[model samples]
Target: MKIGLYFGTFNPIHIGHLIIANHLAEYSDLDQVWMVVTPHNPHKQKHTLLDDYQRLHMVHLATEEYGKIKPSDIEFKLPQPNYTVNTLVHLKEKFPANEFALIMGEDNINSLHKWKNYEYIIENHDVYVYPRLKSGNIDPQFVNHSKIHWVDAPVIELSSTFIRESIKNKKNIIPMLPAKVWEYVEHNLFYRK
Candidate 1:
């Protein structure tokens, strides 16, 4: 099986994320897309994040309806300050029969070179990139790399940060999140600081 790993904080999984993951699962050569919830991203601030399991639950609620997209807590058990290369290596060992790939946005591709052991990641796995409105220069070395696959998925401008702030400000942001996720968030009074 060919699995595409889509890593995110998923502070609260929303419609835009679903669209991109589902699109990749349905349109790309990848057999399934795993929504790998990161426990803590080195690049992101830790204080703003919801608890790891809480975020994972939101991902579960968001992706439960899609057969091709499933939630994963693979990173939860892994050592923190999580690195993509390490996860890939661990996954390859655990699922020896499957071919693992990465699903990311254009913006992530732009910063790929700065990631730890990025060269190994590029050499060993295929990267499926979805469209993003953010513009930045991609590393020249990856410009025409065969390992990277540009997927013409829809350009979604929505973001989790926006949703969080909207909720905090008492704005109705229900439409941005999956129904179950919204219900969970609302019931828990999340982000309503």
Candidate 2:
């Protein structure tokens, strides 16, 4: 199987995430796209994050109906401050028969040098990159890199932070979230701030 790993906190899974995953699965060489739900990111602030399991559940809910996209909590079992290189190593050991690629946004590539063992990732794995709104054009150097594959995905301006704040302020995010996730969030009151 050809799998692409899309790592994120997914504080709350929204339509933008789903769209990107779907587009990658369809357009890239990947047969499937797994949203590797990060339990804890060493680089991001902790207070704004939802519980790991909670975030995992929301991703599952958002991706339930999609056959090509899967929600993964593999990082939950790995070490804290999870790094992509560590997860990649674990994944390779666990699934030796599958071909895996790293999927990321241009924003990630911009600061990728800061990531632990990022060079190993760039050399060994195929990096599928999607454009991010307001990031200006991707650096020409990266655009011409041999390992990087740029995918043309629709840029949805909505973000989980924006969605959470909207919900906290009593705004409707129905269109911005997956139907099941929106219903689940409404029923459970997960992000009431």
Q: How many backbone clashes does every candidate have? A: 0, 0
lDDT of 2: 0.86
Candidate 1 lDDT over residue span 43-62, tens digit each: 67667689989999999888
Point to the candidate with the largest lDDT: 1
Worst lDDT run of 10 residues, candidate 1, spans 39-48
**At residue 99, what lDDT does model 2 achieve?**
80
lDDT of 1 at 32: 96
Query: In candidate 2, which residue pairs get closer than 3 Å at backbone N, Cα or C atoms, i.e. clash?
Result: none
Compared with the true structure, the alpha-carbon lDDT of candidate 1 equals: 0.91
lDDT of 2 by residue, 92-191 (tens): 9999999889888877777777789978888888899888876765656677888889889987777889988898899988999888888888998877
